[model samples]
Target: MTTDDKLVYMANQIARNFEALGHDHAVAATEDHMLSFWDPRMKARILALAVERADALGPVAAAALERLRAGVVPRPQTGATRFAAVDESGASDAG
Candidate 1:
């Protein structure tokens, strides 16, 4: 898919996953809660991570975004855990 298409697709996937996890409100509140501490490049990375790590809310947003861009579908959130796994190399496995 085109880069924009991929970004929008990933965003939709993240929104779906968040809703599935009972955090629909948080997803809705994203525009309000989003911070602006990073530069343009870092901000893009954070947006990308938001899609990959739909379960987590922390400094790892950039990593999650990169993973999604690489075609990885993060592990579904379950139990008491809220974050998906980061690979050994700090990247995410696409499987």
Candidate 2:
């Protein structure tokens, strides 16, 4: 399968895994999983595909992608953002 096809399959799989949770919950879980695990470039591509070929995505996957594209939810924090930086003098850079 093509790259986009693979992405669609993967997204659909993730959505399907959460399908038992109910609609809203499935959407949230799918979005969370993507945000947590997918690279930014992957998300960008998926977002583009979502706009151009939305019909390919499952219902929950589509809703989750929409939420991501709309920026209505918080992004997952990475290790870099999770801690304060310490300077040479040992002072924390955080606020």
Model 1 agreement with the true structure over 1-95: per-residue lDDT tens digits: 66645544544454454554345343432222222122466446556546654455432333344443455543333323233456344333343
Tens-digit per-residue lDDT, 1-95, candidate 2: 99999999999999999899899888988898898889999999999999888889999999999888887674442234344455444344455
Best by TM-score: 2
Q: How do the predictions measure up, each by TM-score?
A: 0.30, 0.76
Worst 10 residues of 1 by lDDT: 29-38
After superposing candidate 2 on the true structure, give the runs of residues whose Cα lies further than 4 Å from its correct spot: 74-95
lDDT of 1 at 6: 56
Q: Among these predicted structures, which one has the highest lDDT?
A: 2
The regions of model 1 sitting more than 4 angstroms off are 21-95
Candidate-wise lDDT, in order: 0.43, 0.84
